[model samples]
Target chain A: MIVAEHKPLKELLALVEGFDRILMVGCKGCVSVCNAGGQKEVAILAAALRIARKRAGRPIAIEELTLDRQCEPEFIEWLEEPVKKGGCQAVVSLACSIGPQYIAEAYPTLPVLPGLNTTFMGGTVTHGVWAEYCSSCGNCGIANFGGLCPVTRCAKQLLNGPCGGSVDGFCEISPETPCVWELIYERLKNLGQLDRLEAILAPKDWSTSLSGGPRKIVREDLIL
Target chain B: MSMKTNLKGILEGSGFAVLAAAPAVCGTDLSAVSDFARLLKGKVTAVFAADNPGARVSASALAVSVKLLAEGVEPVLCMTTRDRNRLALESDLLGAGALGIANVQIVNGAHPSLGSHPSAHRVYDVDAVQWIAAATRIASEKTLISGEAVSGDPSFFIGAAANPFVKTPELHLPVLKKKVAAGARFLVTAPVFDAARLATWLDNLKKSGVTCPVIATVAVLPDAATARHLARAGRGMAIPDSVIARIEKAGDKSLDEAIAVAVENIQAVKALPGIRGVAIIAPGSETAIPRVMEAI
Candidate 1:
């Protein structure tokens, strides 16, 4: 889901104060399901912005466009023609951190402000209900423990077992959440692979999914 | 999750009922206001204030309604904020509260075309949702136009309309959500003349995750056939084939069929998991609503 923290309305109002034509860009792919950067949210934000502006007596021109996904180059191109055509003073993006970077790089002269706080990758439970559940680390280790993730849960990313915080099968940090190692233990025990936890989990490999120069993936067969 | 304290919670032990008595046209005299209030004493009963400056049934019987509620009756104040400005709204709220009446329904109100004052200019500084928000902001924040908080807090049980049976169910859902977000505690729909349409609307509300208490409105007509001859300004109201068929079989001479139709719709709606209560609207047949309430 598009995991994003909503920007305060006052801050957004301040940003578009003098801009004649403002475009509020929204992302639909992940943020839509999470109820963050979707068409509905875009409409709400647009109306609120107009109302706020009207209340302030500015009454500036404003428009909204929600693209499929802002992170990809193909999707970001859809906005290039619209922005140029509208002569937009500024483009406020409602996508994650990666999205703004792409927009800025695509059009160096246009100013792009982000409308979401860019939270962690997560999923939805129901409409208006979203919960953070994963941290993509560009690794596949789920086979060892019945598909339960530990990188996002183990506090210390301890794949081996529980530290001292597992109290009555619950994590100490949050009373509602289950302990990572406890879940691992239960899953391993159920899968007839009880001996897997016996091996000490060494410090996890840190070569992938970290703050570095720039990350890229290679698909050798696609070039042909 | 939305905060609790819905209409059901308010009326469960308080003993109350709404009496929809909207006059078919304007300029109808309401000399029997106190009599209706007296009849509904120590129980929930309401009579619509006809769209007339000559008479407002609620205002006419304000003193009596107050006296009745003082004896443990719950008086609900219903006003559509179409032409009425903030001063009028505040007076109504304060006056009702002075009379121990707390329940209030905020409506965008009907246009003047429904009345003799069609030439009257519509005064809407804000719509129904904004009006309700103003009330909530006053009560919760304890302030007024100048950002000054009142010395004492205001207590109100506010409700708004939701037409789930409307063909544009999508628009209704968003509008209802907006109203709720703006601080409407419950929903009183336009009218439910059909059972299947009511069921469909209930299902759509559930799927849409609207948790507010909705009171399905069973319209009370002089007869079933007259009710079916609906015109514009209120369109897409769902009427069941079974109800229509029943009306056709009964021909023109059946007030019993209309009452039966209203009773059946009430029962059908209440069975929906999300539905909380029923609000009966009787345009000309104001007296019949209480009977349906008693039957239910």
Candidate 2:
């Protein structure tokens, strides 16, 4: 999931303060996991704004809605009649970066802005800590580095091997983070392929990762 | 008298900078005393992050950070809301006063993910600003959230973090002021470790009229291996080439120069008015803080 952070309250307030009737739409997928554009947070943001406006005595009319997924057309259709009926001036999306654009595309005239900063596609390290493991570089070079990624894990992104900075197996960045190369070294050492670095690896081909342009994946049979 | 002026002049000349200190532990200690010296040496204030230098931050680590203050290292006491619950927070604040760590930074830390217990309930009942508001009351010797009476007050220089780079960046300023209005006495930023980034962002904060203690952060990488890990963290952190070069040249050479870079960077940031302190984030180099302070 692409984990993200919500923009500060004041930033969100400034964004929507222009409109009286606002619809805060959230997603139940990816963002829900990251707790950004998820149901609970959208409710919280809406409640916060209501409390804030009421405190100041502005009392703007704000509506909250959450869909299974906002990036899809079906989920957006759920908002049309209600949002259109309620005369929502703007739709605040609590989904990933893509979901906002999708809403804008569907309702060209309707304004859409992100409520969360789409951070990265990462997995649960602990229950809550979600460190980024992939830059979505096109190539899945896991086989080369023994499941651990030197590209994403190493502080300097050293493709070759560990620098001298590894002390007792932890990266100098902090005591918490382990040396990525150390993980690689340990993995390779376990695999009995310690000489893999001796073969002289090539520089990372970043185009495959999601950095170059719009990225896509396909499985022909499953695609249809 | 002139000596004090000269020292103040020297301190003021250094500019805006902050020293990052987490609770010092056996592994992840936020060793405040050592960090206080770094702030003093760099002529920067310290925003002590509540971390256990020995390992993961436990209740015991906070106790250690508090005790260290007695060694004449009365620096700022900093923490994320997630680092401790309100109960623990209240306890630590009381302890900090006992140790004499007057300054404090409050933040809503990221909830533990990977290494954390998944089923643990998030106790963010209070956010950073509210926590500050609550803690500041303790400084006044008022009643606490638990309705407990204190012998004295919780005297503190409260602080918070402001993200300078955002859409409508100017808007964040008022929020910062709100935190200040609520209880915060200072503003410690997740400072742009990059000098260029720092200059532009500092300029923006200036335009916003947020004239609090805008203590800029000076993160110490001092090693290539650590720089790589920080790069992976991919937070807004910017690692300069000079830093990487310093690390590369560090080799078997005595880490004295590496440690010097840490202090020197703090010294450099002290020239900025907004940069009131340095957060000595030596990361794994918790013990190295004293050495860095020696040069400062």
Candidate 3:
């Protein structure tokens, strides 16, 4: 899931300071699951902004709304009714970065602002903890390393094996981070696939990854 | 044809090879190179120039290698994978070859987070083994990793780093063997403080069929404080407590004691099987190198 965190209240407040009234939009997708940009968070942010504005002696208004998913064009249309009625001068998106981009495209006249910082594509490690699991490198070759992606896990993204800095199964970067190559070695050894590592894994084709440039995909089968 | 001077030729000869690591060449000063050459001209085989030791930014190893070459000393240019991608690495190698710098040491550089610029992004486009293989291709096959032909020969006497202290030889040995297979002519190791561990690693190397000559590194600690720091820092390079205690007990003679310890390590490592030479690393100074070599 796409993980994100709320922007500092001060920064968000400054971003919307020019506008007396704004529409704060939230998402019910990954942002909601991560407890970052959801319906409850939207209400809290709206109330906080109201309080902050009222304290400044310039009481502003905010129309709060949460979409099923801001990334889909169909769900983005749901904002039309509230935005039309609220007379909101700007839109604030509390979803992952995708929400604001979609909202900006949908409502070109109003200024779109981001209320949260999109961090990484990751999954929840615990109830309140999240860890990055993939880098979306386009090419998936985890099967070669017992289902572990060194491209995302290893600090250096070493293809062949661990570097000399691996100490006691932990990376030299921090004791908290387990050296992923060591983990791969252990996993492969347990599976009796140690011989698989005998062959040197070649340098990755990074052009398939982010190194190539901004990426895009079009499915001919699904095209109109 | 190979370059006029190369580490492989020196190591392949009958005598025990001695590599003196020059102090970090952080600027345009070639006086250190001349001084180092004058001090160890007849005594050493090659001068090693490290790339960003401690991950702190320093002068290019190729630039230092050029200085060593000018002083009539063979230079081993240490190249790290952390700083540049395959294109830049290949370009540097080609440039080094043109400058008559033949010996190249490939290492997975220390993480940038551990360096002076902790927030700097690292480009490990190719790991050490992959780069070693790519370098070998650029040298021997006259082709790039992309299979592009070079206009001229860019030969190199390739070397790779080894860590004898890794707890998991199950994984380390295969990579070492692969490095040799990928055309690393020699293997230089991290500083060896534990002879037993080194011997075990050597035995494993032999059993794994990696017959490349191993050059053990022996670092000269200037004081007990540095020893304590290294031991506490936990950078994965081991410095035994006994050795640290010995240095600490020396009081004002800690520098001498450190040199003596390095001498002892050199002698001990030279006696072991598969050991071909020792690279003396005297941090912040090359004065200890001559003393360590003379004592050994």
Better of 1 and 3 by lDDT: 3
Q: Output the worst ten-in-a-row residue range by lDDT, candidate 2 chain B.
A: B1-10
CAPRI classification of candidate 3 = medium
| lDDT measured at residue A210 in model 3 versus the true structure, 0 to 100 | 82
DockQ-superior candidate, 2 or 3: 3
lDDT string, candidate 3, A1-224, tens digits? 99999999899889989799999999999999999999999999989998998999878799899999999999999999998999899999999999999999988888999999999999999999998889999999999998898998999888888888888889888888999989899899889898878889899898978899989999999998
**Clash numbers, per candidate:** 5, 66, 0
Candidate 3 scores an iRMS of: 1.0
Task: Indicate which candidate wins on lDDT.
Answer: 3
Error of 3 at A177 (Å): 0.5
Alpha-carbon shift of residue A18 in model 1 (angstroms): 57
Tens-digit lDDT track for model 2 on A1-224? 78888889889888887787888888999889877778899889899988887787677787888899977788888887867799989888888887888889888898988888888878878876888888676677878888888667765455545432344566545658877776776687789886664433433455565446888777898965
DockQ winner: 3
Native-referenced DockQ of model 2:
0.02
Question: How far is A203's C-alpha from truth in model 2 (Å)?
Answer: 50
The local distance difference test score of each candidate is 0.63, 0.63, 0.88
Report the C-alpha lDDT of model 1 over B1-296, residue by residue, as the tens digit.
Answer: 11223343654444333445433332234335545555554434443433232222233334434543444445445666555666666666666655555667776554454345666765543456656777766667765534566655467778776766544454246556667777787787767766677778778877877777777678755655655644222333455556666766787646668788788777777677666666776656656666777666
Cα RMSD, each candidate: 19.7, 22.6, 2.2
Order the candidates by DockQ, highest first: 3, 2, 1
Task: Sort the predicted structures by lDDT, highest score first.
Answer: 3, 1, 2
Candidate 2 Cα RMSD (Å): 22.6
